[model samples]
Target: MKTQTTVRRSKYAPSVVTKNDLLELLNADFTRECRAIYAHAVYAERTRSRDEGAAARIARYGQETVLSALVLCELIYDYGGTVINNLDELNAVLNADRVADPGWAPETARRLHERAGQLRSAGEPGLAKRIRRIISAKKGAVPLAALVSGQQAVAGR
Candidate 1:
């Protein structure tokens, strides 16, 4: 009897993540860290599509907003800047956390906001509106559905 050889496939392949899968992954890290990463990634992707000038501006703003949020979260836990006062100190802590895993840089946050402003001023009101909606949603300032009404009101004027 002759034996046939079997072919083996590589174990690595791209995997798709559903909304629930992403939610589950969020549980793996602290909520603050998760939120920072999510915001940073969104900002990065948005800036990546812009021109150099626009990209730089958006990146700056994005970094600022995300860093601000992170700092706010820390303050909420540590009771109002009792521990850290400046971005440098905050960055030191963030850098350490990033070494163990991955995190956003302050610069990245700033650029995102700048790009967003550029988009708004460049007559891309629809895109700007979307960005504002995303920011508001991420910051929990308003509900996703309510964002539509808010945008409509602004656009109406």
Candidate 2:
């Protein structure tokens, strides 16, 4: 049976989200992570010959995304939600189209942060915290999303 929870938009107004609703968001994020994994893999392979160091770094970011997806799976099960993997559908986009521009990752991270805040307000602090932990505030950090997505350069090129 699915359960619904309330999140306070304000003292006077509250919104409700069913467990399936949460699952929908989680699954969507899972799909996104899968896409990122594919994109990073393509990028890593493409950059391997030209810039081995960059390729390695991109590969590491892809690994981190895998870890993040696992965390989301755990959250899904814990909340009585289903984990769906639509890798085939996610792969429909061309490999070249999959690669993220430098700004895309950070913007995506910012949106995730917003979702985390919503989860927190909806009495899902643990899940929210897990999501938040994946985001990095430090500039030029390890995760590809945060590293290349940020505005500043890596200091020494």
- The candidate that wins on TM-score is 2
To one decimal, what is the Cα RMSD in angstroms of model 2 from the true structure? Answer: 7.5
Q: List the candidate 1 regions with Cα displacement exceeding 4 Å.
A: 1-37, 80-157
Cα-lDDT of candidate 1: 0.39
Model 1: worst 10 consecutive residues (lDDT sum): 78-87
16-113, model 1: which lDDT tens digit per residue? 34434322322222243344444434434443543444334434544554554554344233322122223344453344324223223333333334
**Model 2 weakest lDDT span, ten residues long:** 147-156
lDDT of every predicted structure (CA atoms):
0.39, 0.66
lDDT of 2 at 1: 50
The per-residue C-alpha lDDT of model 2 at residue 22 equals: 64
